[model samples]
Target: MRPGERAVLLGPGEIGEPTVDDWAAWSDTLPHEVVTGLGARLHRHLRPAATTTLRSL
Candidate 1:
């Protein structure tokens, strides 16, 4: 999604906003080292997806 755009995940039921503890729990479910490595790879892969917008004065 673009900046300021809203996104919703459609599943069997509505997913509510996550709390700090919820995030902590979710993080605990994943392998931290693997997740961190994947994050770095994803960042490298998606970095070029960012673009700059120009406005005329």
Candidate 2:
């Protein structure tokens, strides 16, 4: 990992109740690193595109 390296953080299945509170309640279910590893980067929590993720920031 380095500066300008884009990483799309996504969940393979339903990570939570589509809300932060629900997820936090059972935070153990999620990988511990998911919370601590994020820095000042762009993050989009959504379903990944079948081909490529194209959208407007």
Candidate 3:
């Protein structure tokens, strides 16, 4: 590990968008202390696509 560097795990979702369950499962595999320290902000960069009203309209 390097200074100011964090570890990231790519989830099974397309484009790496981890669902709530996926995130929970991944966190469950890690040590309690590690998960606690990292907090919810972990992997915050990944996001699901937003919906638009005009889609399929």
- How well does each candidate superpose onto the true structure, as a TM-score? 0.27, 0.25, 0.24
- Which segments of candidate 2 are over 4 A away from where they belong? 11-26, 29-42, 45-48, 51-57
Most TM-score-accurate candidate: 1
The order by descending TM-score is 1, 2, 3
Report the C-alpha lDDT of model 2 over 1-57, residue by residue, as the tens digit: 999885534443353323333344456544444455446584655664456646563
The Cα local distance difference test for each model comes to 0.40, 0.48, 0.55
* N/CA/C clash count, model 3: 0
For candidate 1, which ten residues in a row score worst on lDDT? 40-49
> lDDT per residue, candidate 3, 1-57, as tens digits?
998785455444556656444666767754444436657766556545464335241
- What C-alpha lDDT does candidate 3 achieve relative to the native structure? 0.55
Error of 1 at 19 (Å): 0.4
Clash pairs for candidate 1? none
Model 1 misses residue 28 by how many Å?
1.2
Report RMSD for candidate 1: 13.3
